[model samples]
Target chain A: AQTVTQSQPEMSVQEAETVTLSCTYDTSESDYYLFWYKQPPSRQMILVIRQEAYKQQNATENRFSVNFQKAAKSFSLKISDSQLGDAAMYFCAYRRGGGGSNYKLTFGKGTLLTVNP
Target chain B: DTAVSQTPKYLVTQMGNDKSIKCEQNLGHDTMYWYKQDSKKFLKIMFSYNNKELIINETVPNRFSPKSPDKAHLNLHINSLELGDSAVYFCASSQGDRVRGTQYFGPGTRLLVL
Candidate 1:
């Protein structure tokens, strides 16, 4: 079984600043997918960014980027130019590369991010 | 248009009561899934359906039942709900391709069992 861990229970970042949320996972699969999801107070989960294990280059989406280290089993999310809208509960998820049950996502407990103005 | 939707955004029921949460997807995806977010905010997969067929059934309790009447709708019926059953239930959909497709999730229904 694969388990994702978010060591930081809470994180705070000032507006227009940058912050990073740490994430680590335990999985034996060579090829997999890592994802960061944001859940606002509205309870809607939104995809922030995704990284493929095979890709050496980190994935960047707008102000959201990921530092994916396959060897260390670490996948951290970096929020740049953070805004008030970035305040939410961020989750790190892992998914196997293939179809069927392998596609099921294993999510981390979540890190509550607070953006201060 | 909403890609995925779930009814009763908030549900409050007494223990031992039976309740059903309905889910529908407007996207033409072939796979749908039900996920549970516990109090600690740990999200886990409970059930998954593909094209009206049951695919992945996690180690969920028998009190929880998932029914897919069609490819676009998957409803969850919980019988004799308990206090431990209180959690936010999310419905999601994705393409059934060999490659892992991105899943679109619903807003989620918060169930509170008293």
Candidate 2:
């Protein structure tokens, strides 16, 4: 079974600063996907960004980017120019690339992110 | 328009009671899933259906039942609920069970079993 680990339980950053949430996974399969989901106090799960294991180029979405190191089995999320709305519980999730049971998403325990003004 | 939606945003019921939460997706996706977020903020997959067919059934208790009347709708029915079942349930959908397909999540239903 694949497992995702978010070492940081809580992270805080000042407004307009940058912060990175650490995440690592143990997966034997070379083909897989990693994702970052944000859950605000509203309890809504919003997709921050995603990275395909085969793609060496990191994924970027506006102020959100991911440093995906397949060899090290590490995928960390970087939030730049952080805003108050960015405060939320961030989760790192993993899924198999294909084949049976690939539909499942294994999520980490989540890291609470606080943005201070 | 909301891509995915779940009804009864908040549910409070006594133990041993039965409750049902409905989930619908307007994204025209072929796959839908049910995930449980426990008190510790840990998320896990409970069930998944693709094209109205049960695909993935995690090691969830038998008291929990999932019904998919069609591809666009999946409803969860919990019988004899227990306090341990109190948590947030999220419904999500993707274009297919493919690797790159991004799953879009719903607002989530917060269930509290007293």
Highest TM-score among the candidates is held by which one?
2
TM-score of each: 0.96, 0.98
Query: Which fraction of the native contacts appears in each prediction?
Result: 0.63, 0.72
**lDDT of each model, Cα atoms only?**
0.93, 0.93
lDDT (Cα, tens digit) per residue for candidate 2, span A1-116: 89999999999999999999999999899888999999999999999998988899999999999999888999999999999999999999998887654467899999999999
Recovered native contacts, candidate 1: 0.63
Global local distance difference test of model 2: 0.93
Q: Which residue pairs of candidate 2 clash?
A: none
In candidate 2 chain B, what residue range of length 10 has the lowest lDDT sum?
B93-102
Error of 2 at B98 (Å): 2.0
iRMSD (1 decimal) for each model: 1.8, 1.8
